[model samples]
Structures are given as structure tokens and as C-alpha cells.
Target: MVRGACTLTAERADTDRVLDALPGLWQGFSATLIRDCRLRFRRRSELANPLIFFALVVTLFPLGLAPDSTLLSGIAPGLLWVAALLAVLLSLDGLFRDDFDDGTLEQLLLAPQPAGVLVLAKIVAHWLTTGLPLALASPLLGIMLSLPGHSMGILMSTLLLGSATLSLVGAIGAALTVGLRRGGVLLSLLILPLYTPVLIFGAGTVRLAVEGAPLAPWLALMGAMLALSLLAAPWAAAAALKLSLDG
Candidate 1:
């Protein structure tokens, strides 16, 4: 009985520590995100390049898939949105790689703040850099893909909501794989399967509209996913970074 009581006490203490750390962790995460954004945008041209590349990738699909506007319009939302997802995935590696390579990641771990907050901040920076652009540029790509103007709004909304979740989930995989010399491929390997659910719902939201079906359930699921990832991914990411540091 005493041993059980002691175990419960220890668990409660750990939980209390995690709870106590939340606010500072959140602040530290936000600060790191801002710093990363500033550093990334210092090269304005480089920062804009992802948008251009996303546009280019979307344009290539119509040419490669079909020049038929009818077919393109039917498939536009899925293609363009999924393309945006892939663009973010392609760029996710850079989120932690630079920090890891230059030792900024180590400082992040050693900071007075909890690592979870630090991870959250990195993810916030990542969303700002990769996900936000994808959301903003999605409409243009939507048009290129022959998506109807009405559907374009939905496309933008879903991408904005969905990409936030993507960055969080991707960050965990990025942290786990960061220490590996050849991590880029491995990161994708670990993360892509995890990303499919978001892609399904993100693309499904538009598909439902295209087919004249109710969108509430799909969008709700997307929101649920975002909430789940937002609530959970930071801690997992922090743990992965700790492991990486220890190794």
C-alpha cells in the first residue's frame, strides 16, 4: 500500500512540474519562432522562393497530368492542396537542420526554459515559414489548377488550419531525425505516413464541396487533428530533441 501511494505521489509531482512549465515553455517557444522567422526572412529572395517553387510545382501538374480544364477543375482542389502539403513537407527538414548543424539546437535545449516550450517555438517558426506561405499562395495555385473561385476560399481555409497541424507533427519527426547524418530522407519516411490523415481531410474538405456534400464533418475532423497535434506534438518534439542531445 505504501509503495503504491509513493508511486502515485511521484507521478503527481512530475505532472505538476509539466503543468508548471507550460507557460514559460509557450513563451520560449514563441520567442524562438520569432527569431527563426527573422533569420529566415533576412534573405528576402530566399524566403520568397518557396512561394515561387510551390507555384511552379502546381503549374507543372496540369501540364504533366492533363491540359483539359474540365478534368483539371474536377481534380484541382485535391491536386493543388496536396501539392501544397508536399511543398511544406519538402521544406520541413530545414526547420531543425540548420539549428542542429550550427549548434543553436543545443543552446535551445540548455536554456533555462523547459525544452517543450523551446520545441513549440521552433514549430511556430516552422509554421510561419512554410505553412503560412502555403496557405497564402494556395489560392493562386488553386486558380492555376482550375479550382472554382468559390472552392478557392475553402481551399485556403483548410490549408491554413491543416498546415498548422502538419508543422507540429513534422517537427517531432524532424527533431527525432535531426542528429542523423542523412536525416532528410529518413524524416520523410517517418513523417509522410503520419501526414496522410491530414491530407485526406484537407483534400476531402474540398472534394466534398466539389461533389456538393456537407463539409462539416471533414472540417471538424481537421480541426480535431489540429487541436490534438497542437496539444501533444510539442512535448514529443521536446523529448526527441532531448534524446538527440543526449546522443
Candidate 2:
């Protein structure tokens, strides 16, 4: 009886420690996110480039292809997804490049907090500065492309989910190529293939929305991808960062 009672007490103490760790972990994560966000947005031109690139790519589709609404609407979903993916990819090369150049990334790896948490925070910052803005700006491009009005919501939704997934996936590529002088091309080559599934379902979501079909399945797939990527991407990215640091 005494042994069982002691065991219960030990379990309770372990539970208490786990509960206590949650708040401290959250504080650390939030602080890192805020710091990275401030650093990223401090320069206006650099911050605006991705959003601009997204818009330009979308805009060019209308001019390059026929201006007819029927044809444009048919292709808009894929066009937008492809453009957003490229924009996200463009921003990724710089994810750890600057930090590596100046040794800040090394500092982050050495910090007491887990490197996975740090990588997750950086990914969040990347999504906020680059991905979120692209999603917000997408509706304007959608309208310009003559995309069906009803599809606008789904377009934004997919970009939000899809872009977050892209940022997470791209970070892994970024971490791996961060030490290279010509890392941009290598990052794109490594990440573009991994990006294919998200691109397919993301464009499919908007296409279904435009056709007035049920959206649950595509959105479900996207949500599942997001969940799985959320669990896996940061840890993979952190490991890549450690490898880069080793050399």
C-alpha cells in the first residue's frame, strides 16, 4: 500500500513539472517569433518584394494569356497557386542566409531552448512576413484574373494553409542550403518537388470552389498535410540547421 501511494505521488510531481514547462515554453516561442518578425519587417523594400512578386506573376497571366474571362477563370486556380509557390520559394533562400552570414544562426542553435522550437518560430515569422501577405493580396489578383467571385474565399483559405505548409517545407531546404553561396537554385530544386502535392490540392480547392462542387475532401487533404507538416517540418529543419552548422 505504501509503495503504491509513493508511486502516485511521484506521478503527480512529474505531471506538475510538465504543466509548469508549458508556459515557459510558450513564452520562449512567442518571444522568438516577435524578435524575428521585427527584424524581418524593419526593411520596407525587402519585406514588400515577395508580395510584389506574387502580384506580378498573377498579373502577367492575364496579359500573357488571352484576356477572355472564360479561359482565364479556368486557369486562375493553378496560376495563383503556382505563382504563390514561387513567391514563397523566392523568399526562402534568405531564411537562414543572413543569419548564417553574420553568425546569428549559430547563436540560435546554441541557445538553451530547443532548436526545433527556434526553427518553428522562424518558420512562423516567415509565414507572417511572406505567406500571410501573399494570401491577403491574392484576392486582388484573383479578381484581376477573372476568377469566379464565389471561389475567392477558398482561394484565400487554400493560400493561407498551403503557404504555411510551404514555409515549413521550404525552411528545411533553406537550412540545408544556407551555407552555400549559390543556394537559391539548389533550394528551389530541392523544394519544388516536395511542393508538388500542396500545389495540386491547393489549386484543386480553388477549382472545385469555382465549379461549385463540394470542397470538404480537398480541404481535408490540405488540413491533413498541414497537421503532418506541422509535426514534422520543424524537427527536420532543425536537424538540417545542425548539419549546416557542423560544417
In order of listing, the candidates' clash counts read 2, 0
Among residues 3 or more apart in sequence or in different chains, the pairs in candidate 2 whose N, CA or C atoms overlap within 3 Å are none
Model 1 misplacement above 4 A: 1-27
Across 102-209, the per-residue lDDT of candidate 1 in tens digits comes to 998889888878777778877887788778888988888777666777777788889999999999999999889888888889988999999999988898898777
RMSD of each: 9.0, 8.2
- Expressed as tens digits, the lDDT of each residue in 72-96 for candidate 2 is 9889999999999999999999998
TM-score of each: 0.86, 0.89
Full-model lDDT, candidate 1: 0.83
TM-score of 1: 0.86
Best by TM-score: 2
At residue 123, give the lDDT of candidate 2. Answer: 96
